[model samples]
Target: MCGIVGAIANRDVVPLLIEGLKRLEYRGYDSAGIAVIDGRDVRRVRRTGRVAEMEAAAQSEAFSAQVGVGHTRWATHGGVTEANAHPHISQGVALVHNGIIENHDEQRERLRALGYQFESQTDTEVIAHLIHHHLTQGADLLAALQRTVKELTGAYALAVVSRAEPQRMVVARMGCPLLIGIGEGENFVASDVSAILQATRQVMFLEEGDTAELSRDGVRIFDGNDEPVERELHQSDVSLASLELGPYRHFMQKEIHEQPRALGDTIEAAMDVGFDAALFGDNAGEILKGISGVQILACGTSYYAGMTARYWIEAIAGLPCSVEIASEYRYRAAYANPDHLVVTLSQSGETLDTMEALKYAKSLGHRHTLSICNVPESAIPRASELVCYTRAGAEIGVASTKAFTTQLAVLFQLSVVLAKLHGKLDEAEEAGYLEELRYLPGSVQHALNLEPQIALWAERFAPKSDALFLGRGLHYPIALEGALKLKEISYIHAEAYPAGELKHGPLALVDANMPVVVIAPNDRLLEKVKSNMQEVRARGGELFVFTDQDSNFSESEGVHVIRTPRHAGALSPIIHTIPVQLLAYHTALARGTDVDKPRNLAKSVTVE
Candidate 1:
C-alpha cells in the first residue's frame, strides 16, 4: 500500500530518485518523503500530501543530499502526517518499506527496552531503529539488516541505507516486490517496474529470503544461509510507449482507451499452436486431475474476476467452482475434498488477503493452486504450481481497466485448456472456441471506438448520486465490478445485484433519482436480464443498457440501448466491460477527484 524508490549514483542521486517517485505517484500519493546522504550525514525532506508538494519542498534551499531513498505512502498502520511519511530515519539508518510489519509492537517494545527512541507513528520506524540498534552493536550494514530482519515478522520489501556506510545500499524481500535496476555507475530499486522503467530496463529480481547489497559499481546476492548465490538478470522487455498517455486527459481515460490494445496483447500471446494438453503446466493441472471441485479465493476486482471464472468453470469445464472473497474464506470452514483446486486471481498478485488465503488452502491440504496475475514474479505466483500471467503490462490506474479483462481472458483460456485436457470439450468445440478467440482483438477495438456513446451517457447521468448495475450469471460479476469502479473513484453510491435479485431487496433502493445500468449482452441469460431491465423501468428508474445490436434486447421496453458487437457470453465479460469502465472514468472526472490516484486507494496492495 506504499511506493518506494532508492538509488545511488557516482553523480548526485536526488534528481533520479525524484523522477522515480513521480512515476510511482500512481501507486500512492497521500504523503511523500526522501532521505539522502550528504557527506556521511542524512538530510531528510518530507511532505504530508502529493508528490508535487514534496517536490516543491525539496527544491527549497535547506534540503539537498547526494544519494537517496524516497517513498510515496498510502497510510496503513499510522495516520497521514509529514513525520509519518516514509524514509523513516534513525541516527544513520534511513529506511523505505512497502509492506506491514505484523509484529511491530514487539519490535518497538524491544527497541524501547534497549533505550532507542522512536520519532514517528509507523510500523516502518521500528525498522529504522532496529537497523540502527544492530549497527550500534558493531555490526556492518548488511549483517545488521540480515540480523534485524530475522527478528521481524510479517511481509516486507525493505530498502535500507546507512549514512555510516555511504557507498552501498542493502535490500531484502519476503512477500513483497523489490527490483534492482542496473545503470552506468548508478543503480536503482523500486517496488514496481513503473518507477525504474526510465532509468534501466535490465533488472535482477529479488526472491523471498534473498538479500541484495548494491553499490555504485554493482550488486551482490546472498541466500538465507549466508552463502553467495548466483542470480539471473533479465532485461525487462516492456515497451515504454505503452506507459505514455498519448494526449489523453487522464490515465484512467487513457487506460480505458488502451483496452483494445491491452486485450489484443493478452489474446495474441495466449494462442497455443498445437493440441497439446499441457496449457496448465508445471504440475498445476494435476490439481484438476487430483481434485473433484475448485475453491477460488480473491479480493476486490480480483474477487469479481474469480466470480466470472466460476461461471466458465461450471459451464465450460464442467467443474464446480466456489468463489469467495479471501478475507472471508479463512473464517469459515467449507466442505472440501482432497480433489479441490484452490485458484486465486490478483492484478498485482501481492494482495494480503488472497495470499494468506492461498496459504491456508495449502495447509488444509488443498494442494492444487493456480494463480492468474498480470505482473510477473509477484508473490502469489511463486506459491502456485501453475500461473497464467496476463501480459497486459503495467496497469497504473487504481481502477483497473486492462488487468480485469485480461484476468478473465486468462481464466477462460485456462478453462478451455482444462476442458480439452479432461475430455470435457471435443476437438470441434475446441476449434470453435479458438475461432471466437481470434476475433477478440477486433471486438475489443470495436468496443473501444464506442467511447463517445459512454461519454454521452455520462453527460446524461453524472449528476445522479447513485446507480444500480444489473446482470446475470457471468455478467453478474461484471456488474459487481462496474459498481465497485463507480463507487471506488467517483464516490457515488452504487450497488450491483444479480438481475434476478431486483425484487429481493435491491428494488427497494431503485427510484426516480437512480440511474440503472443493465448489461443486456446477448447470451442464454439475455431474456432474464431483459425482464430485469423492465422491472427497473417500472420503478421510475432511467435505464442505460449496453447490449448487442443483433440481440432481441434492443426491443426491450423503457431502456436506452447502446449496441456493441455480438460476441459469445464467455467473451462478453471482456467486451461489455468497456462501457462501464468509461462511465466510471468520466464520472470520477466529473466529481473532480484524482481519477488516476483515487483517495485512500493505491494501485498495488503491497501490505495486508
Candidate 2:
C-alpha cells in the first residue's frame, strides 16, 4: 500500500503535504517525497527512509509552494530507493501514484518510441511521461490526465501537479481509493481521509474511474464517461485523536486493548434494534431468502475471519459455506451459483484483490453481493448490494488487532441472523445467543485483563526463532491468527495447524527448541486439544497455552499456561484472540522490533 496527498491553496502547502504524509505513515512506506509547484518550477524532495528524513530535507531546502503533492511509497515495481520514490517528475509534470499499472512495460516502450525518457523504474513514472506527452501536444493538465488515464489500464489513485499550472491539481481514482478534502479557499486530495483530517473533515470519496480537478476556488469531478458529475460530500467521522498514540507505546498495543470497546460498538446497533435482515441493508432480507449457501472472499486477516465464519455458518446456520483467498479466486475456474451469496470482508474496504474478486464473481453471474467492512464510504461497500460496517474506527497499525476481532463479532451476528432466517434456532435459543452477544464485550475485557500474564509468557517466547500455534475446531482460525501476529510484529518465523494435524506433518518440525503455542478453550474439543499437547510435550517442545480459566490444565516443566477468562462458547475465538495479540505485542517489545509498522508490510493491501 502507498499513500497520496495533494493540495491547492492560497498559502504555502509544503508543510501541509509533509504533515499529511506523516499521518499516512501507518499505511506503511519505505520512502517519502513531496513535489511542489514553486513559482515556474516543479521542486521536489525525496528520501529512501522515513517521512521525517524527507521532511528535514524539505525544511533545509526551504521547499514551499501553493500547489503540491506528497507520497509515502510502498515499493511494488522497483526496489526501495530515492529514485523509485514518487512525485516522479517528467518535464515539469510531477505525479504520485498508489496502485499498479498492469501494462506499464508496453506503455513504457510506447513512450520511449515517442522520445520520452524515464528516470525511475516505476509504473508511476510512465503516467507522468504520458501526461507530459499530452501536455506537449497542446493539452491542459486536466485534459492530459484524462487522456492519459484512458490509454492506461489497471488500478491507480493518481495526483498530478505541473509547473505550468501552479494553482491547480488533478486527481483520479480507478481501482484504488482517492478522495477530495474541502476547506475554505483550499482543497486537498488524498488516498485516505485520515491523511487530511487535520486540514478538513469534509471530503468526497471518488467512485471508480472518476477524475477530479482541485483548485483554490472549487472542485470539479468527472465520471468514467467523461461527463461532469456531483459526488456527495461527506463529513468524515474519523477523529484525529483515534490516530494518536496516547498512553500506549504503539498503536497496535492501544488497538489490542481497544477490542472490548470496538466489539461493543460494532454490535451496538444490532443489539438495540434486534437482529433482522434489515440490519445489513434494505434488501438483505430478500437476498437472504434467495440464497442457499455463502461464498466468502477476503485476503490476509480478513480471510482468516472468513475462515472462522465458515465453521459458524455451516454448524450454526446449516448452510454450505466456502472461503477463498481473494487473490487466487479470480484465476481459477469455478462454478458461481446464483443461489449462493457472495460475501466480501475487508477492514479498510479498499483491498484490491477482494474488490476485483467481487467483480469477477459478479461477472460469473453471482446474483447477490454483501460487504462486511469497516469503512462505509469505501469502494467495496459502495459496490455491494448489502453492507454491514464494523465499527473498528480507523485501525492505524499495519498489523490489525481490533479490526479482526470486530469483524468476527459482525460475522457472528451475521451467522445468528442467517440461522434465524432458516429456522435453525427457535426464540429461546436465539435469545440465548443474543444474550451472549451482549456480554461479549465484557468477555473480551476479561481476556484483556490477562495481558500482564501474557506479557510474561512473551518474555519466554521472544528469544525463539520459530513458533507453531495449534487449536481445535472453531479456534483453528484463531491459531492461524496468533501465528500471524507473532510473525508479523516480532519477526519470528511462525506456523499454525489444527491440533489433529500434528502427526500429519507439523509434529516433525517440533523438538526441544521449538516453541509451541496452543489455544485450548473449554469447548468440546479441549480434551482432544490436550491430547495433542501431550505429543508436543513428548517431543520436548515447550508449550505456551492460552486456556479457559475453568480448565484443569496447570503449569508444569516445559509447559507455560496463561488462563484467559471464561470461554463464551461460540464467541470463544474472539475472547482467545486478546491474549495472543498481547503476546505478540510484548514479544515485539522484547525483540525491539517495530510493533506498529512491521517491516515490509502495509496496513491496507491496495495492490495485487
Candidate 3:
C-alpha cells in the first residue's frame, strides 16, 4: 500500500501535503517525491528512504504551486531508489500511481517502438510516458488519459498533473482507494481519508472506471465513455487530532480500543439479511451449497483470520477448507478443482502478495470467487463473484488491530450464513450463534475498559527480555498474535505454544527468570491450561493468566491473574485480544520505543 496526495490549494499547500504524507508514511516510505504546477511549469523533487529524509533533501528548494501531487513509494516493479520514486515526470506531466499496471512489459515494448525513452524501472513511469505520448499526438489531457487506460490492464490509482494545463489535476482509479476532498476554494485527492483530514472533511470516493478532473474551483467526474456523472460527497468525521499519537503513547493501543465501533461499522457495511442478499444475493445459499470446497489466501493478520475460519467453516458448514499465506500460495503446487471456491481477504485490498495470489487463483478457474475486504471498490473486489466488505473505517495504526478483529467477525458471520444455507445448524443453534455474535460489540467494549488494569499489569514485566505465551485451539493463534505484537513493538523474545506443548519441549525453557503471559481465555482448554500454569509455577516461572473471573482455578500460587467478566465462545478472542494489545502498548511505552511507528516496519506491506 502506497500513500498518494494531490492538492489544488485555496491555501498554501506544500506544508499540508508534506504533513499529510508524514502521518501516512506508515503505508509506505521507501521513497518520496512531489511535483508542483507553478504558473510557468511543473517543478519536481524526488528522494529515497523515509519521507522525513526526503523532506530534509528538499529543504534547499522553494516549491511554490497551487496544484501539486505527492507520493510515498513501496517499490514493487523496481528497486527502492530515487530514480524509481513516484511523481515520474515526462514532458512536464507528473504521475504518481499506486497498484500495478500488469501489462507494463508488453506496453513498454510498444512504447519503445514508438521511440519513448524511460528513465526508471517502474510500471508507473510507463504511465507518465504513455500520457505524454498521447498528448504529443494532439489529444487533450482527459482524452489522453482515457485512451491510455484502454491498453492498460490490472489495478491502478493515478494522479496526473500537467505543466501545459497548470490549473488541473487528472485522476483515475480502477482497483484502489481514491478520494477527492472538497474545500472552501480548492479540492484535494488522496489514497486515504487520513492524508486529507486537516484540509477538508467532505470527500467523494471515486468509483471504478470513473475519471476525475480536479481544479481549484471544483471537481468533475466522468464515466468511461467521457459522459459526465453525478458526484456524491460524504462529510468525514475524522478530526486532525485523531491522527496524532496522544497520551496513550501508541496509535496501536488506541486502535485496539476502536474495535467496538469498527466492528459495528463492519457489520453495517451490509445490514440486510432478509432483503438484497449480501454479496451473494437471492441464489447465494444455493450456489454456496453446491460449491465443493474452499481455498483461502491472505497474509499477516488476515491469514490468521483464515486459519480461524477453517475451523468454523468446516464444523458449521461441512466444507473442506484450506488456508495458505498469500506470499507462498502462488508458488506452491496447488490442487485446484472446478468445484472449489477461492477466497481472498485483505484490509487494504491493495496488498501486493494477496493481489498476485488472487489473480493466479482466478486464472485457475475456480467454482466461485469471493473477497472479504475493507475497501469496497478494490482490485480483488472487482475480480470476484461476491464481495463482503468490512467497513472498519480508516485503521490508522501501522499494526492492524481493528482490521484483524473485523475480518474474524466477517468470517464468523459467513460461517453462520453458510451453515444456514447447508442445513447444517438448526434454527435454535443458529439463533444462539447469531445472538452470541451480536454480543461481541458489547463484550469488546467492556474489554476496552480494562486498559488501565492492563497498563498496570505491564509494569511488572516490561524489563524482562523474554516472555512465553500459551493457549490451545483458536486461542493458540491469539497467543501467537499476542507474542507477535509483544515482539513487534516491545522487542521482547516471545514464543507461543499450545499449552499441551509444555511437556513436549517448551517446558525446558521455564525457570524463575522466565515471565510467561498465558492466554487462558475460558474455553474447553481451560482445565488443560491450568495444568500448564501449575507446571510453570512448580518450576518457579512467573505466570500471568488472561482468563475469566468465573473459572475455578482463580489464582495460581505465585502467578498473576487478569480475569475476564465471563467466558463466551467465538467472542472471547475479540475481548481477550484487547488486554494483549494494551499489554504490548504499555510495555513498549515503558521501554521508550516508538509505539505508533515501530522500527523497521511499515503499516501496509504493498511490496512483495
Q: Show model 2 residue runs off by greater than 4 Å.
A: none
Which scores greater on lDDT, model 1 or model 3? Answer: 1
- Report every candidate's CA lDDT: 0.82, 0.92, 0.80
Estimated TM-score per prediction? 0.95, 0.99, 0.81
Model 1: ten consecutive residues of lowest lDDT: 270-279
Per-residue CA lDDT of model 1 for 11-84, tens digit only, reads: 77777778889888887568988998889788888888878788888888456655689998888887988878
lDDT of 3 by residue, 485-557 (tens): 8888889888989899999999999987778888887678788888888899889999888888667655646
Candidate 2 matches the true fold with a TM-score of: 0.99
Worst 10 residues of 2 by lDDT: 270-279
Q: Tens digit of lDDT per residue, candidate 2, span 1-608?
A: 79999999999888899889999999999999999988898899999989999999999999988999999999999999899999899999999999999999999999999998887889999999999999999999999999999999899999999988887899889999999999999999999898899899999999989999999999999999889999998999998999999999999989998888899999998888777888898888878867899999999999999999999999999999999999999889979998999999999999999999999999999989999999978999999999999998889999999999999998998898899888898988888889999999998888888878888888888899999999988999999999999999999999999999999999999998789999999999999999999999999899998898899989999988888877788989999988888889999999999888899999889998
Model 3 lDDT vs. the true structure? 0.80
Model 1 vs. true fold: TM: 0.95
Better of 1 and 2 by lDDT: 2
